[model samples]
Target: TRATDSPSPDVSPDPSPSEDGDNSEGAVPEGYLGSWSGSIDNASGHSTRELVIRQGEVGEAVLTLTAEGPLATGGTYRCVFEASLTAEPAEGEAVRIGPSTVTEGEPMASCTPGSPTTLTLLPDGSLSRENTSSGEKLTYTKSG
Candidate 1:
């Protein structure tokens, strides 16, 4: 598949709280409730990525990532993954995603097949993600 031909992931906005004040089970952290999009260019190629964070059914942060770009073998591909937020310490409560699970496409050799990932939310409402294993770093801005 080509990068432009890749299907856009379903990115719904955060659900509104119920009328009866019953948001206990689905209360997502304020800082992590939005859609972010960005692209990274490197020697291999450029990739367009989107990240969506929303409240989970059990009052946890659910993060979904969709990335599409060219492959080393001369074609394009898309991959999607989902993860739940876990505890971590950072300058303003970084939102970490993991024990992540790939939800689409074959696992790329560069990214950790089954490891946790962290996303640092800057004070200016931007996001920074770094994959130490693959030495991949990307900066994303909040999407309107």
Candidate 2:
């Protein structure tokens, strides 16, 4: 199980699908702030990623990197993966993402975008993404 009680920062509940359809709990589930990481391996190579999705003022999920890499590209990546459910550097979990693409893939695509990745809490207290960017599935996991 994940180490600390963590929660995504910005999660809109009761959002109408057309307008919004999901019936999410108001704000992220309790204890949805902490660290999470994951990794990935494909034809290109392998990489590890870790993010500290912490609570912010007015209760918004913010990403504070605890672990990254050298020469990693710089730019806010579409943090479409959930903190608990999908961000575990698991082998098969879909790291579905969006417009935020490194294009170059590895080596240069290491520096994560210095922005708060919008993390939404799922009803199951897990996390998920929508219209996330399509990039190399760099499996990252929480270390701290």
Candidate 3:
């Protein structure tokens, strides 16, 4: 599956301002607006993934993920994942990413869409993601 720009079903809606009104429109935390890359080690094997976070119009964001590596079915593969940032995060809280859907997957790749994932911006300039249902945890470092 080649990477595609199509929107995913789990793409999050525009974020709404907090009741306290702390966040202004289009004011994405600087830390979350960049490219991140990491590797995944799961039951199937090892693979690499990249995530890019982009700010959209006021109070909106777009997130895209790309994973590539050997497939379980015995071939190389690649897939693109997408999700939207739904809610505004309070100061020092993890950015809430809506459920992720596979935008594209290589011919032999077995892609399974998962529940909403959270990207925690660490103090050390790193990020971590934990899938609530799959229990797959991936740690990423800022790349660009």
Which runs in model 1 stand beyond 4 Å of their true positions?
Answer: 1-27, 57-61, 88-91, 106-114, 132-136
Query: How do these models rank on lDDT, best leading?
Result: 3, 1, 2
22-133 per-residue lDDT for model 2 (tens digits): 4433233334455666554434444445555543322322344333333323433332322222232223333312223232333443434432233444455444433344
TM-score of each: 0.65, 0.35, 0.73
Candidate 3: minimum summed lDDT over ten consecutive residues — where?
Answer: 19-28
Indicate which candidate wins on lDDT. 3
> Per-residue alpha-carbon lDDT of model 3 for 27-48, expressed as tens digits?
4577788899999776668899
Candidate 2: stretches off by over 4 Å: 1-29, 58-61, 66-126, 129-144
Model 3, residue 51: distance off in Å is 0.5
What's model 1's TM-score?
A: 0.65
How well does model 3 score by local distance difference test?
Answer: 0.77
> Taking the tens digit of each residue's C-alpha lDDT, what string does model 1 give over 1-144?
569876666554555566333744443456767899999786669988898888654324488888888778777777887877665435466566656666787446544444666677777878887664565667889994
